[model samples]
Target: MSVTAQCPRPESRALRENHPVMGADWGPFNVIDTAKQDWARGWAALKKFTEREAHARVPYEHKEGAYPLGQWVAEQRRAYGAGQLAGLRARRLEKLGMVWSLADERFQKNLEAAKAYYDQHWTLCAPRTETALDKPVRQWLSNLRRPGALDDHPEWKTAPEAVDKDWNPSWPADWQRHYAALRERVRDEDGPADVLPGFTVHGMDSCRS
Candidate 1:
């Protein structure tokens, strides 16, 4: 329901180049891409839980392969939220946080499954396991580069626009745009029959693998 933290993400090439220590300061990222109307309400009410890891074969990007959007989302929600309970201190979020990390040791297994599921030979979606090079620098960046920032980080030198200026409370502009796109409710181009000729809707994840 309410996401107050961000699961660590691998730095984009743009980010890493601009801010070498890009981890500590980015802030909470609670958005998950889903079309389920009950997501927010469901998340706000459910207890944290996990199931056995699963996989499937599917076609993607003009080719056929296997996908782990299933397992990846599981880890994305379950494993990432294991630490949320303490912060929220509310039984509801705590309940939603789960007893502990699910798929705890299945990172490698799930990643392989997701990577192979896509039709193309893609590898960029893997989870981030690396540590930032400098904690203080990263933290400064997260606070919108408050004080004692790197004098010449690429961001400050060539791209001042990359600096954070808005400080209200809602999602940043770019992310807001992204969420707007995802949260929009629009009719399918025609209908499922017109588009998905042979696809399977796998629970929340509709795919044919």
Candidate 2:
């Protein structure tokens, strides 16, 4: 049977009230794909990455390569209030050097999980903000790492891939195959498919518990 549940919407007030660094500014990062698949994959990546990174979504307004923290904050303030501002401040806290995951067991586990996915999936680009095409992707990855308050979003636990903005791979590849399989489920029209062909819905079931 198919399942019907509401996807999490932006919780602006919760983010604003909880996050400490409310008015700070952040980056000009990016992620680019060598090619486009169905729109679903790209959208999922964008959502997943943004949620993971904790960056608020902004319209693609600035001309490429000039995603200013000040500009993003100014734009988001009208709706997101201090929550978006907090994301900016948190960006400064990002550690630039190599981080050893083994130092923390829980982090190590998460890193291992991320690495396994990274190894299994096809990531066509390195994700950089120096260029116009890759900026959004880069910022998304940055946010996922330090999601301060946005971590409360339920999608963080369910359909995690939905927010990873940097996700991109060539067509007919394994990741594309995975995406295509899931796309079929979305087409059911009435509700989400309980089991998508060729993909296993693992830990997601545990969420019901």
Q: Which candidate is the best by TM-score?
A: 2
Segments in model 1 whose C-alpha atoms lie over 4 Å from true places: 1-39, 44-92, 96-100, 103-209
- Residue 65, candidate 1: Cα error in Å is 30
Q: What is the C-alpha lDDT of each candidate?
A: 0.32, 0.38
Q: Residue-wise lDDT of candidate 1 within 1-209, one digit each (tens)? A: 88798665664645644563553343234244663444443442232222221222111221112333334334435534675324443343344333333333232233333334221211111122311222232222234334544353433332222222221124443343232222221234444333233432212112221
TM, every model:
0.15, 0.18
Candidate 2 per-residue lDDT, tens place, 1-209, comes to 99899764567645544556542221112234534342234334434445555643433452213434334333434324445333432333222111122123433344344444444332323234412222343344345546463356443433334423334333433444355435443555686556533445321221121
Q: After superposition, how far is residue 49 of candidate 1 from its true place, in Å?
A: 8.9
Q: Given candidate 1, what's the lDDT at residue 167?
A: 18
Determine the C-alpha RMSD for candidate 2 after optimal superposition of all C-alphas: 28.1
